[model samples]
Target: METSSGKKGVWAKIISFDLGATGSKKVKFYRQLFGFHSTRRRGTQTRRVFTPGILSKIPHLVLGKSVVAVPPEACSQLLDFLSNPQWKPIQVHVVDGLLSAEQVRRAVEEFFSRPVRLTGGEVPLSQAVRAVSRRDAGDPDRRFVERLLDQLGRFEWLKEAVRRAKEELSR
Candidate 1:
């Protein structure tokens, strides 16, 4: 896994290639060859693909969405891979590193100007709540919220969010 320059986020692959050269020239050569951009932030250098433009060059067979139910910022690190275009033969996987199925589908569809299907299952309610709330609330707390929401007739908030997401994706 690769962490983006103390950004405290992890990516699937972090590669280091030695061209036998040092300094900024090496960074330039690497960027020219592989299209990975390097940035020096707070005295540390980090390599990343900041924009979707570089995705035009990659041949992605499949795009995968995660079922972790994390917020957008938590999974923003995966944009480099997710924004790539895919072909018919490619198969998509619902793995870790996405905000939500409908959101990603909408993004991919909008960027490629094509209808796309995102496959994923509902995250476990407990897991979903924790990830959504960004906290490690215990069972009693979760149960309390569930019961309170049910009593208040707002228990369907998650489902409603998903439905709204689908509606957004359709546009």
Candidate 2:
């Protein structure tokens, strides 16, 4: 999928996988690994909710898809999986937009790990400027903001605004 700029479209889809019957070992393991909590609703129906800090390690199971969505809290586990050389080139899409695309991309690049293309939208220019303005010089996100500014500088329509944002951030 390509947009007007010829960049491949970033698409996201939500899929449900049944881990077997309720209370089974497969179901229990999936719940524990994904940090899913069960709560009873009206009648006997139960709902599963995802919580953070539950995944300690990547499961031995292999995902057939080339892209997988993981929770933000499992960053460590995700990193471990990416660091492993045995797996194929799979792109990781953080399930919730808890982390920015630039942040994830920077982290993956810094670690020299596998390439991970984040799903969803990029940070807006105004938001990027605001973030850079709010952060201190030592902030890690400063580089991302700088890169965004440089890219925006090439567009004639955004050049002036990008220049102003950079000038403000410098002060």
Candidate 3:
């Protein structure tokens, strides 16, 4: 059945890539609130890339009736993208690294003007990894490896690695 907005399902489009502190919260928000469980299919990664190369794709994929929860780091870039005259109008909300249920509900309501009930709970790191991994078979070890690869490619990790490498070389 379609919602009054003509959109099907309750899942929100979240553009979070990492499973770290902030990323974890966004993933949990998508899962618990929107029931957006990542399918166990290869190449089902979230279209969260914010580069100019994929900007058009991201807007096409997510700019619709579903509420989009953007990570704080992507907020500025996403805002800039939305500001482009060529881009269509879209609703967005930037979530902090952590939040309470009340905060989440308020943010959603403010962005979409619809009341939403959010459950508050912690998803274990291992389980979150398994949930977000693209492996067809549910293997804990493989999920962990996939999660590590995902984390390592994040901007924050790259920045830290470069910083540490520079320090070690200087010393």
Q: Return the candidate ranking by TM-score, descending.
A: 2, 3, 1
lDDT of 1 by residue, 15-81 (tens): 1222344577555543543344334465565533222222222212133221122223323333433
Q: Rate the local accuracy (lDDT) of all candidates.
A: 0.33, 0.43, 0.36
TM-score of 3: 0.24
Return the top candidate by TM-score: 2
Per-residue CA lDDT of model 2 for 63-150, tens digit only, reads 3333333333344555564444433233344342233344433432322221111122234345556656867887756766677567
> TM-score per candidate, in order?
0.17, 0.28, 0.24
Candidate 3: Cα lDDT at 21: 32
Compare candidates 1 and 2 on TM-score and give the better one: 2
Per-residue CA lDDT of candidate 3, range 121-167, in tens?
A: 22332343334344444565444434443443343313343244333
Between candidates 1 and 3, the one scoring higher on TM-score is 3
Error of 2 at 82 (Å): 32
Tell me which residue pairs clash in candidate 3: none
For candidate 2, which ten residues in a row score worst on lDDT? 111-120
Query: Model 1 residue 94 lDDT?
Result: 36
- Superposed by TM-score, candidate 1 places the C-alpha of residue 128 at a distance from the truth, in angstroms, of 27
Off by over 4 Å in 2: 1-123
